[model samples]
Target: MNIENYYNIDAQGQIVSFTREQASSFAKGIAGDFNPIHDEDHRRFCVPGDLLFSVFLAHYGVSQRMKFEFSGMVVDSTQLIFPAQLSSHMSLSDANEKNYMDIEVSGDNSKEAEFISMLSEKYVQFSSKTFPHILVPLMEQEKVMINPSRPLVIYKSMEITLDKLSGKQIELSLKEASLTNKGKKGEVRLEFAILSAGEEIGHGAKNLLLSGLREYDASQLDDVIATYTQRKSEFLAVA
Candidate 1:
């Protein structure tokens, strides 16, 4: 699938416009993210954080070492502009200049279309599986649950460091995932390794902030999982 179709971007002007439909499509189609908040009709609909990250990489390319720090949520129909010029550090903001994310890149960088596409595609697929495959078990172990009424788990930041990168295809493996709780809030860290031809070359971590967390209830958590699974199935059936 063409990445441009998923994200409407003006490369010359370095601006992006996100519609609710596109957001929902990227969540389900590309990231396998079934979070209700990404649903176009949901009350708190917001663009999937992974979608934003993927767009950035596709536009600005990838570096040997990179960091992404998110400050605000990008809502549907919002317009975002890339920095006027590429640099080691840049901030992504809306038309009003409200910063949504900060990005820093260092070391070797490649704007090659093939390299960027491969890296973004591989990393996003791994990142999106953080939900049931990783976070659910982590939350259960921690005995805390995000508010089921309006579950909010915000992508805080992510960093990747690579020894070297050069390949036609890339693979990502989850190395570890951990959660830390403080009062009603929690932080989740997902560590991963990058491999090319079965040789490890890079490492990265995705950090998320969970808010409105409460003591976990088995029944409630089960209901949440059931709902999420059903949503996935429904989408798959229609697709």
Candidate 2:
């Protein structure tokens, strides 16, 4: 996926803005995420959080170990302002310093486009499947589910640990998908392994925060899944 098509950067090398179309297209084209909130014409037209994660890695270089904590969502209209460099701990914010994400990095780094592209594509394809392929089973096992009308699943954090940053083409496989909840809040952790040429190279976890949880309702969830699948089908058919 050519992530450069998803956002704009000024001549000064700072990311400037994301158009609704750009964000929506990236969500579908690369991440295979058809969430309506990412629809160009949706009322809540926000850029996919995974897009931010991808842009950060593309620009700053991927480290052997990294963690990203998202604090807020990014609307298409928000012009992002970034730090001059990627330090040990960096917070990405808007012009008014409205922090949206915090990043922490350590270990060796690679700026090679081939490796970065492979990693970005592999990681996002896995992360984007959290909805049904991964989350549904976890929710069923836990006997808890998010609100069907206002499903608010937040990208709390994601971390990756790589044994080394060298790989011709990357592969990511889900090692486990688990959920731990208390009261109305739940955290879903999707642990995955990174491999190259069928050999394990590293691992990572994508953490999601689900709020307004309640006892799982099979009927309600089935309806929700039907809606999601219908939207995805319609979008793809048109595209």
Candidate 3:
């Protein structure tokens, strides 16, 4: 497969692009700093978290084909050891000499080590949705399409809370379908209905259901679906 299509391309051959706002927000989120240093016009600098998220996104590859096998692929969990430093205007450039994945920053070794430890823990917690699996399928189904993308609906276990007003156990039904093709822009449409115990609770139009389905774990797909479907059938039989 072509690796080039696996990521967002940049002139510097990196996988992601970021704006000053994004960088600033990342720094603020991780460091808990509302300082002006990270702003475009501010003299303050970035915190450990900013560098961690940026480098992670920069190195990770995401593409249309990859999205298809979203939860099937696993990332190298060891490479996320540390965070990089950010001061001013900076961007990623291809490092052809290095065969291994490592984060590089412009601080002293002690600072680097300190930040690395903090960032590693942060990423492990933040990457919950992406750990060990790509998670593209679940995202696609939940957000892009009303129907399941894998010809199956999987769950560890689904519990219905009837007393809850939010309607915990609900099924989405699709309505009219549409397609659009314009260069790199491809489109599809699906209408949906929310049902609980065979009773309609809500209905709506969803454009991003396909993207939500991408986050599903491949191994659990079939087992989860079978269990849920069987339970639903039994409930119906009793009713």
Candidate 4:
């Protein structure tokens, strides 16, 4: 879709703030698992895809490019190549151009690329009005867990008082959850964060979400297939 003309361009751009509770909730809505780590308690974890997709949705809603509606979009395909963990803060910026747009998401450095690509594609799809907003959280910072890290899930909710929110207060919240089993010993670790007006929030909510994923054991190609099958089913059933 040639969406350049349809958006309300923001040359200087604006930043959006997201709480950990908000991010976790968004991830749960999309992935159907409320991982607690992404919330307030677990000050140290995040949902990967949830963080990425949330930023994309924020761009779609806040940008001059599109309008928000229930029955909005249809995603053609989403390939998550890396993990996108959440951090304390998250933010998004929208810049318009002649033929396309440039969107930037500031989270932790770990999942920046993965988050960018996933959100980029989502941005295209949503801008074209192919699907409703994806249940993803747009964050300001992200944290990728590596090594013999104990992986956990979290779920949470928040009520921000907003003592003083000016210059476009974009409240970011996450609700979906996805966790990767320990990979090969030498693989790269992953993490992410959200940015808001060049600032970060403190002490986000969190909870463990392992019970949400079905148990499966596999190796080689067969194991990969089984895992994908289970994940596909899970993704389909989410609200």
Candidate 5:
């Protein structure tokens, strides 16, 4: 995983900017995310959140336990800086110090490039599948669906804890999923396991929010999923 291919950084190691194409490409090609919000032509185009996670790992490497909370969405050409040292809590922010992600990390950290790269690719692959593959079914089970006309699925936060830190090939599988609804707002929690050589090595949880929820309308929701799938297929066909 060549993380530098996804974002631009200066000689001093400060992330300089991301073009819309870079963001869109990273979302589709690297993370397998086809969210329209990340599309280059979208009205509210923003860099894929997973790209930031990858950059952090690319710079600071992986930790035994880590958590990330997204506070704001990033647009093109925004400058970002990572701390030179890790702390119990850290912020990934811009030149103005406007924070986008709040990070909490503890336990020993590994700066091994190979391990970090593999873990990043594996983790993003799992995170990117939240839409139709995981969240749709969970929504159906909860008897709710996000608004089709103005669907808003937010990347709220994610965390992981590892029992060990060495693996060449990493894999992930969902172990549990649940959703808690509060009127039109809801939180979807996905718990997954990290597997190496077919054995559990770590566990993680990704939490997302869905706004403008409504009664489950199978046909309408299916249309949304279909649209997303179609976009992915079309992109691949052209790529």
Candidate 6:
């Protein structure tokens, strides 16, 4: 797949505009993210955070140690511009300069096209599976659930530190996952390790914010999972 097409970046490698169609396609096609908020017709539709991360990597390249912090949501047809030049730190903003995400890079960096693409694909596939596979179990264990009506889960931030990176393919495995709740809001930390040839090469953590949370009901949670699974199956079958 031509990753650039998913983000609607131009020939100059700048994201002039993003649309709901593009965001929806990227969420389902690239990340397997079936969240309703990513739906084109959803009232509260927002671009997938993973899509933004993929665009950043496609433009700025990947680094040995990197940090990404999300500040605002990108709505449909929002006009955005990638930094003209990359620095150790950069912020993605709109035409009016409203910041959406802050990115920081340190340590070794790689500009190899193949390596960046491989890493991007591997990491995103891993990150996208956080929902039912990881978050569901975690939420069940914590006895809390995101509000069944709204179900707002925000991608907060992520950080990665690597000893070294090589090879054409990488595999990610969860090292640890924890959820902390304070009243109605909760924070989830998913710690993961990157491996190649069955040897660890790097580690990272993805943080998510869960809002409007309430006490979990076993039947309600089961229903949610069932819905999610059916949606995923339908998507896969269509693909």
TM-score leader: 5
Candidate 6: Cα lDDT at 144: 93
Question: Residue 166 in candidate 1 has what lDDT?
Answer: 71
Q: Rank order by lDDT, top first?
A: 5, 2, 1, 6, 3, 4
What's the residue-level lDDT of 226 in candidate 3? 59
Question: By lDDT, is 1 or 3 better?
Answer: 1
lDDT of 6 by residue, 1-239 (tens): 45777766677866656688888888888888899888899898999888878778777777888999999999976778887887898888887899999999987776767767777777888998998899988898999998766778889999988887566457889999999988799999999998876778899999999999999897888888788889889989988
RMSD of each: 1.5, 1.2, 20.1, 18.2, 1.1, 1.5
lDDT tens per residue, model 4, 139-224: 10112221113322222111112222222222233323233333321111112222244343211222222222222222332443
**lDDT of every model, 2 decimals:** 0.86, 0.88, 0.32, 0.29, 0.89, 0.84
The digit string of per-residue lDDT tens for model 2 on 1-239 reads 79899899988887667899899888888888977899889897788888999999989999989999999889977988877787888888887889999999999888988888889988888888888888888889889999999988888999999997878668899998889988799988888999998889899999988999999998999999999999888878988
TM-scores for all predictions: 0.94, 0.96, 0.21, 0.26, 0.97, 0.94
Model 3 TM-score? 0.21
Residues 1-239, model 1: lDDT tens digits: 36788778775867797889998998998888899888999888888888888888877777899999999889876789887667898899888889999999999877777766777788888988987789889998999988887778889999999887577568899999899999789999999999877888899999999999999887887888899999999999989
Candidate 4 overall lDDT versus native? 0.29
Which runs in model 4 stand beyond 4 Å of their true positions? 1-13, 47-49, 57-149, 152-239
- Candidate 2 CA-lDDT value: 0.88
Enumerate clash totals for all models, in the order shown: 0, 0, 34, 79, 0, 0
lDDT of 3 by residue, 1-239 (tens): 11122223345543343345554544343333332344445443332232433344334311111101011111212122211443222333323232222222321222233233332233322322121122234333433222243321111111111122233234444444443333223244434444555676444332311222233354455554455446445544653
Candidate 2 off by > 4 Å: none
Q: Give the Cα error of residue 131 in candidate 1, in Å.
A: 1.3
